[model samples]
Target: MYRISVDSSRCQGHARCMAFAPEAFDFDDEGYAFVPDGMAETAELSESIRRAEANCPERAVKIEEA
Candidate 1:
């Protein structure tokens, strides 16, 4: 499995992460991106997660093995 998170401090609300992986991320009231608690990771989702990480202009998306 993988643990995904976003660095709110670094996120600029560009939403590129959401664009790439909407199923893996959600937005706060202020528009910062967050990974919802206990999201399931599938092989397809992992691929999208990598794209989201790569596309983040602020480099806010984080992925770690769980």
Candidate 2:
């Protein structure tokens, strides 16, 4: 499975993640980057998600295999 995580402390509401991959990311009321619940897939990784992960200014987006 592919899992995505955003460290709340590190998130600065840049929205780059959401902008890159709206289907994989979103914002909270405070505008922090967050991965919507149950979003990880057992399928392959997506380009948007990869770009989002790589371009996060805070390096907050984390991708892990589990």
Candidate 3:
């Protein structure tokens, strides 16, 4: 299994990750990407998480096996 992680310290709040995968990433009031607690495991969400990790401009998102 793969887990998605975001390093908020490096996030630029560009929202590109959210645009690429809204289901995998949520934008806070300030437009930072946030992953919900349980959405990581759904089959519908895995590709989106990968896409988000790939498209993050800051390279702040990552997916690793659990």
What TM-score goes with each of the models?
A: 0.85, 0.90, 0.78
- Clashing pairs in model 2, backbone N/Cα/C closer than 3 A: none
C-alpha lDDT of candidate 3 relative to the true structure: 0.75
lDDT of 1 by residue, 21-62 (tens): 888889899988888886644433468789999999888888
Question: Over 4 Å off in model 1, which ranges?
Answer: 40-45
Q: Give the RMSD in angstroms, all C-alphas superposed, for model 3.
A: 2.2
lDDT for each residue of candidate 2 in 1-66, tens digit (9 for 90 to 100): 787788888999989998899999878888797887877653678999999999999999989996
Q: In terms of TM-score, which candidate is stronger, 2 or 3?
A: 2
**Pairs that collide, model 1:** none
Sort by TM-score, top down from the best: 2, 1, 3
For TM-score, the strongest prediction is 2
User: Model 3, range 1-66, lDDT digits (tens) per residue?
Assistant: 667767889888888888778777776788777778875544343666677778888999877666
Q: Count the backbone clashes (under 3 Å) in each candidate.
A: 0, 0, 0
Q: Report each candidate's C-alpha RMSD, comma-separated, in the order given.
A: 2.1, 1.2, 2.2
Ranking by lDDT: 2, 1, 3
At residue 5, candidate 3 shows an lDDT of 62
Model 3 stretches with alpha carbons more than 4 Å out: 41-45
For candidate 3, the 10 contiguous residues with the lowest summed lDDT are: 39-48
